[model samples]
Target: MKYVFDWEAFGGCLGMLVVLALIPIGAFVVYFIFNAILFILPAIVAGAIILAIPVGLFYAFKEMVFKKVE
Candidate 1:
């Protein structure tokens, strides 16, 4: 008796296994990215606000001091 190997079926099963393996890895990648953005967004916003306040005050004071009365 001789046995025959089916390349097509093997390839299909291999592809399915690879796809299944990637699902968890892809989920973790997305999860980490989302968490990182959430963690960093507040710091970015706080820094922007902190920098803006000083610049805004300087501009406000400049306008008040330099404006001429008509």
Candidate 2:
């Protein structure tokens, strides 16, 4: 007995394969954007904290450490 190939089913499977290939690419782009945002968030928070520390140190020095002896 010989088997027959169904062109319509083959074409549908091909199309589905193409769609499946694209799914990972789309998901990768989305995942990269999300992780990039997550990574940048900590850097932004760290920068803010670092900036505040100097300002606070300067304010404390002026207020308490360096006093006018009059």
Whose TM-score is greatest here? 2
lDDT of 1 by residue, 13-42 (tens): 557546545655555565577886664655
Evaluate model 2: give its lDDT.
0.54
Which segments of candidate 2 are over 4 A away from where they belong?
Answer: 36-70
| Structural similarity to truth (TM-score) of each candidate | 0.38, 0.43
Task: Write the residue-wise lDDT of candidate 2 on 1-70 in tens digits.
Answer: 4345456655655565465456445545655777866556555555565566567556643444333444
- Candidate 1 runs further than 4 Å off: 1-4, 36-70
* Positional deviation of residue 7's Cα in model 2 after best superposition, in angstroms: 1.4
Whole-model Cα lDDT per candidate? 0.55, 0.54
